[model samples]
Target: MPSTSIESAAVDGRARTPRFIQRQLANLHKAITTNAKIIQDAIVADTGAKLREAQLEIHLSISVVKELYDNFSVEEALSQEYRVARGQDWCDRNDAVGTIYLRPQSHNLVYSIVSPLANAIAAGNCVVIESNKPHQALSSKIAEIILQHLDRDTIAFVENLPEPPSKGVLLIDQTGEIPKINASSVHTPGSSARVVALVDRSSDIVSAASSIVQARTAFGGNSVYAPDIVLVNEFAMKEFVQAAKIALSISIEETKGQDITASQATCKIAGIGLTEKELRGSGANVVMRGDLGTIAIVEDRGSSLLQRKIYGACLILHSVRSLDDGIDLANLQYGTVAPRNKTLLACYHFGAPEAAKYTTQFIDSYASFVNHAPIELTVGPAAPIGFHPSATHRYRPAMFSVPKADCIAGDSASRSLASIFRAEAKAWSDVYEKQITSSLAPTRQKAGKVVGFFDQGLITGFVVFWVPVIASAVVGSGYGIRAGIRMTRS
Candidate 1:
């Protein structure tokens, strides 16, 4: 039934006015507020996130909904006046290109969906949030809860949202990923999470190690944004490891996000004094053969770890020569199109402001943090870092629609960029009008008779005399005032 309604919406691809979209979103918001506890518990039950973390996600979701509901306007979406453009001179006008199909993520599912969902709603287009295997139950539950309140024709809820339709697939990239801007792929960003904590030699060892452990244990290391590896200076590898072990309060067996269903791999190589080659070599014993959910403080020995993605509640410790070297290694490992090819956020920690500034120039991600890691579930107390990159940058509401340039000013003469330019243009225009009028004062534009003054270039001659004359008079008067002041002083 939902599919049929939604398919009908697709025919026109213009189901919503801005006010209607906001009103529908407000209904969803009211439903969410009324069923807040159900949603929170659903997230916890579905994703294994702790209660507090689940609460934060729900709060963020509600915030986004309210923000979109209040901020979105139908008239504003279609057209806006450009203040400087006088009238009919210049402005920006937005046109909804087509429909947007939103896809939820595999893990941290609720937090993931809130961001893109809010944006799609704000973009004021036909929005459909369809579910996949991981999101089947939750999506069905949400569809059941929220669908009744939403406009079925304008916005649809597909309990099992299918693969994106071939029509109006907004993205085409050589990167092989179908562009999250269109539909999220089966391999979500969580699969290739690469968060490295760059600890410089000058950093306080205990503070650095404790904070690193605190971040990984945040939401029990379930977030894709959590630290997977700690790359510290080789100068402090020993002291750092001891402090980190104290801070890591849980055993490797207790790691939350590990798939008990999948086989665990670890190795003797995740030990002291293993060489770089030994760690990366094909020898089975030297490889990390089992899941090291516990902290493993190995030397900066090369491991398939950097070359691969680790989603478990795991932290691999490695040493680097300098903070700059750590940045280089992170970029090599986590930068887009790099070996791992998926990193949404990266962080750099330095002791001094200068050091932090110097190191930041090379770091890359959809978002980057200095002095602090991007570790929080949401921007509140437990994890103090306050950036929501996905909602803010990666999938901004701006992406869903395109703003076009328009002219609203009177005519070409009134379209000047500056006040002076407008005045000059108006003055010249008036003079041209005056000249034509004066020439026609004695004789009118007679039938089949060319205006003799126009043919004699009277208007052009007037323009030539008056334009520079007005300009020079203004310039000369300004200069004359300045010269008079100087002479009086003399």
Candidate 2:
């Protein structure tokens, strides 16, 4: 498709009424909900996801469309449109970006595409999706549903994005590559971004193990939100490892009757109980391997496993000395001169509230969860780069729009420009001289007893030295007087 077609469609999208956008979103929701079963089946067939997982993906996709539809109100839209005309200020007003070009990932195929697609439509932007993976059943099904429900002119699907992409296009790339096109883009770091989990000594071992295990094993464990490597407090490592073993066992048992795809089965490492020395040569020790996943303990600090993101159903564990140690390890980049900061996709801090706070304060991640990884994140594309993830929605409507505030009020300056222009030089000079001549004294603070460690140590030393000397002097004086009294009596 030519870039001109997309540009023209964007022009038409901007001209659409709020009512039309709402109706189209509703149409999408109905179509998705009506064909929920087919979509779920297609997801499983294409991705080899379990039936239950596929069902959840379909459910989340429908919810995305429904939420956008329900939040949109024609009356509010009309009010926003006429606010400036009525001589009022619209503080939160935003205009839709002209066009949204989506390059979606295959992870959770339904939710990944539907999320941005719904948000774009709801925000009144034309959409152009890159759906080149027709070999996948889920991709074809999604393209079919979208084309059947949405207006043909407002949306288009191409095998590839137009080269030298049109200016002012909003590109949403979930495929993880930073597009070289000339447009504003939102793209995930893809497999390069890592999600880390910190298990403090104060954390609930069982709960942390359960949550991390489930996250690592769900949907064949390819989720971007899954823990790439867990940093467990050294004191808690023993208990955490035991808990994780039990959790993994229970998870595997739950899926015993379910079909295991060849890809998922291949993720399991054959030999268990491999010695640390033997694995140290290879960088990781496999503690246990099962049909569902493998649990490995990282032995090397500079291991590639610690530096890169894990894409399979494997859980990697490493021990840290303390919360600060965990932060250091989390920030460690194998070959970089400086530690990684603000580069993690997300951090799951499983510990007491204070420990969690400390971990989050020092470790920079795009999003931080205290104890549990929200299951919703496992279903959608990683939150777009430079945008925070929503608790409810995967992609927010604001991400699709740009701030275009409608302000009618005048600036709140202390003095009017006309008044300044009319003021005499003597008046201005007097004001300036008064301001400069005024005394600027620092405020007094209340005095209190010094209670720092060094101060306390000094006080303790004084008492320790003087008490012995004073007691000895008194005792010597009494002994001398007693001796003198006895001699006089004799």
Candidate 3:
């Protein structure tokens, strides 16, 4: 990887117009869809992932290119480019950040590379993808496809980082480790962080179990979004465990007899039953294990499984006393004096909306899901650190761009501090006195229904009590009037 190549790519990226970028993305999309089968086969060959999983990765990869192409507008881009010349303020304007260095993860190699590559190109950036795994079938195939369709000057696949790394380069590192290079980077530190699923008693046990099992076993359980451990409410433990066993059994049976290469041997699960003494000594008890995955129960918080990341299809189940207990367990990091907040990669809260909201509020994670673990998350690289996770794509176009606002109009609401400073001492005193004497306006109430459980119960009681009584009184009065009329007639 020559330093000059990246430099040339960066220069070319800056010169690329929105139309040119859009055309390139369109070509890439066409190329991917045309060669979808080859890509899918390569994915399966490299990762030993199921054919369906490979198909999904290919589909998602094509979607990335399509999404970028569809969302990009040549008219809006040109307008922003010449906003200042047209004497208009371009608020919230962003320009491409030149070259993007992508280090993709290996779980879903096709999706990992395609997502950032497409986003960077759509944002008018040149890309330098680090495809060091040339021996990998998926990597080589991706390089072949990308190079054939994309502009050569604007895109280069290098096995190593460019020597004497350039400044102002945006590094998208999905390899988990924070890049040691001296450049602006959007690295997902949480890729290596623990992802925990909290299953409250209020949650649907069957749904939670199904989701947990699928997420844990999908794509050989290499997804970073897969829950490293599950914190089931103590009250729901029995039912949850039962449901999880059924789900895991079904998943294992589905993937039975699939080819397991030497690389995938680690993902295989063998059934084992540990005694009470063994469970306490080991801090984990394997309840269910099969060809596809394993399910273990970890009652001890100090268990090493709770402290570290689980890369295979092993689901660690722990009983939590309450929502607070789940939160506490989710924040478990070994060797920390006090539990750190917001250290989790992602939190999956399986409960009622109220319980999920409470869990999310107290637990700090990069991403939080209420009920389901998204299958999309099991494919692409984790969202860049400090940015909100997108439900559709891994990296947004804006992440590859730098803020470049053009201001042509003055702000009317901005007060002049100079005017206040220039005021005379007596004027300042008068202004201070006026401010001190002025009554503060009351805070406006928040909009929408603010009713709580007690309030709702009271309203229900009022309606239930008054409606029947009122109806009875009206009926009795009508009956008496009818009888009086009959007596008068007689």
Over the stretch 433-480, how does candidate 1's per-residue lDDT look in tens digits?
776878334565558756686666977887899889999999999999
When sorted by lDDT, best at the front, the candidate numbers are 2, 3, 1
Give the lowest summed-lDDT range of ten residues in model 2: 265-274
Looking at candidate 1, what is the lDDT of residue 466? Answer: 88
Candidate 3: tens digits of C-alpha lDDT, residues 239-346: 998999999888767767767563364244311222345444768887877667778898777776677777777788989899987776666551122654347778
Clashes of each: 18, 0, 0
Alpha-carbon local distance difference test for all models: 0.58, 0.79, 0.79
Q: Give the CA lDDT, 0 to 100, for residue 308 in model 1.
A: 58
Q: Global lDDT for candidate 2?
A: 0.79
**Top TM-score model:** 2
TM-score of candidate 2 versus the correct structure, residues matched by position: 0.84
TM-score of each: 0.64, 0.84, 0.82
